[model samples]
Target: MREIFEAELQQLGDGLVDMSRLVESAIGRAGTALLEADHQLAQDVIASDHEIDRLERELDERCVHLLAQQAPVATDLRIVITALRISATLERMGDLARHVAEVARGRYPGQAVAPAARDTFVRMHDAAVHVAGRTTELLQTRDVHLAAEVEKDDDALDALHQETFAAMLAPGWTGTPQETIDVTLLGRYYERFGDHAVSVARRITFLVTGDFDSEHAPSHRAEV
Candidate 1:
């Protein structure tokens, strides 16, 4: 019975890793679609949303099964609960990626920001890709230390986001008043990308420490 339970948990971990990979690719493709104005790539990412949703539902069901049958305790319970948390974060990442892709589709034949701002967005995209990649590492290794690296990485993205925001606020940024609003949202999308990565890092910390401190409010309930 214990062997079967461990195997089930291992499969749950595998599903989280796979979901992370899918979201990473989706976000990367969305970024490319945004920077390059590639509607087709954006469309592909948009169309892939159903696949992500399907994965999330399947993972949630597996988590429920693990809890129902295994009745995990201590570290085992932590692992199962962490899988649920990670799945939620991954699903949100997919949503953000799809949102970016939608913006890319709307970019048809024109854009809302300066060409220089677009270049900066390209850099932001790179930073987000790095974060997404590390999410997979965190799950695969279950390393709180590696997850710390992602928190540090979020600082870089925050820096980029601030700079982009400042640039957007500059006098000549908006070609039209309407365009200004769009540019602001574009920056927000990038910022929220970092935010999602930070959330994943926090989940990793929870998995290891069984506490959600270093977050806004620490979690008191123990998975065990």
Candidate 2:
């Protein structure tokens, strides 16, 4: 019974890694579609959302099944609960990416961001991609150091989000009202994407070390 339970736990971890990989691809492609106004890519991203949702549901059901059958205790219990939280976080991240793609699709055949604000949007995309990639790494390796790095990427995203807003409000800004709205929404989607990535990294840190503070926690130690 113990052996079977351990196998189930390993399977849970594998599912998380797979889900993170899918989200990483989604955000990367979503950013590309947004930048280029590629209708087909945007459509792809939007359609892929169903798969993310499916994974989330499957993970949730697995967690429930484990609790009912394995009756995990102490650290094992924590891991199961944390997996549920991380799955929800990843699902939200997927939604944010889809939202970005939707913005691109809505403005198909025309760039979503205006010329003057393109640089800021591009920077936002880069930061988002970095955060998403780091999130996948942290999930697979459980490397606490990657969690701190993910937080740093989130900070970069926050700065870029502010800069985007600043540009929209700058003097003599000439973008049409609709264009301004698209840029605003795009900035929000990218910012939220970073936020969700950071949340996942922190949850992984908690899962590994039972310590929520990634910065102060010793990298080499985990209570489990």
Candidate 3:
């Protein structure tokens, strides 16, 4: 019975790794779709989000079953509960990627980001993608150091998000109202994407160290 329970725990960890990989792919493709105006790719990213959702539901069900049947205690209990939380966070990250793709799809033939803010959006995209990749690595390796790198990547994304607002407020800004709206929304989508990634990182860090940094709690509200 103990061996079987241990195997179940391993399966839960593997499920998280799988979900993180899907999220990483979603954001990378979504960024490409946004920059290149590839309507087909945007549609693909939107469709793939369902798989992430399905995985989350399935993983959560497994966690619940383990809790009911195995009655995990102490560290084992923490593992199951943390898996549930991490799966939920990954699902939200997947949703943010889909939202980015949705914006791209809404704009269709025209690019979502305006010419002046294109460079900033590009940097945001790169940072977001980097953070997503790091998140996947962190989940797989459980290396707390990778969590710190994820935080740094999110900081870069935050700075780029601010740059978008500064461009819109500049005296020489020439974007139409519609363009301004697109820039604002896209910047927010990318910023929120990074925020969710940070949440995942902090959660993994907590699981590894068995200690939550009061300054960097796993709560998304605290991070945002």
Provide the lDDT at 182 for model 3. 89
**Tens digit of per-residue lDDT, candidate 1, span 1-224:** 99898789889888988998999999899988887788899999999988888899999999998899878898888788878877987898899889888888886556545574776777878888888999889888988887778876677777787777777777776446545565667667767777777777887787678785654444222111
Per-residue lDDT of model 2, residues 123-176, tens digit only: 888888888889888988999899889989988888888898888899968999
Q: In model 3, what lDDT does residue 14 have?
A: 95
Q: What is the number of residue pairs that collide in model 3?
A: 0
Clashing pairs in 1: none
Best-first order by lDDT: 3, 2, 1
Considering every candidate listed, which one attains the maximal TM-score?
3
53-117 in candidate 3: lDDT tens per residue? 99999999999999999998998898899899989989988998999899999988998888999
lDDT of 3: 0.90
In angstroms, what RMSD does candidate 2 have relative to the true structure?
4.8
Residue 95: error of model 1 in Å? 0.6
State every prediction's TM-score relative to the real structure.
0.90, 0.93, 0.95
Residue 168 of model 1: what lDDT?
A: 71
2 against 3, candidate with superior lDDT = 3
* lDDT accuracy of residue 207 in candidate 1: 69
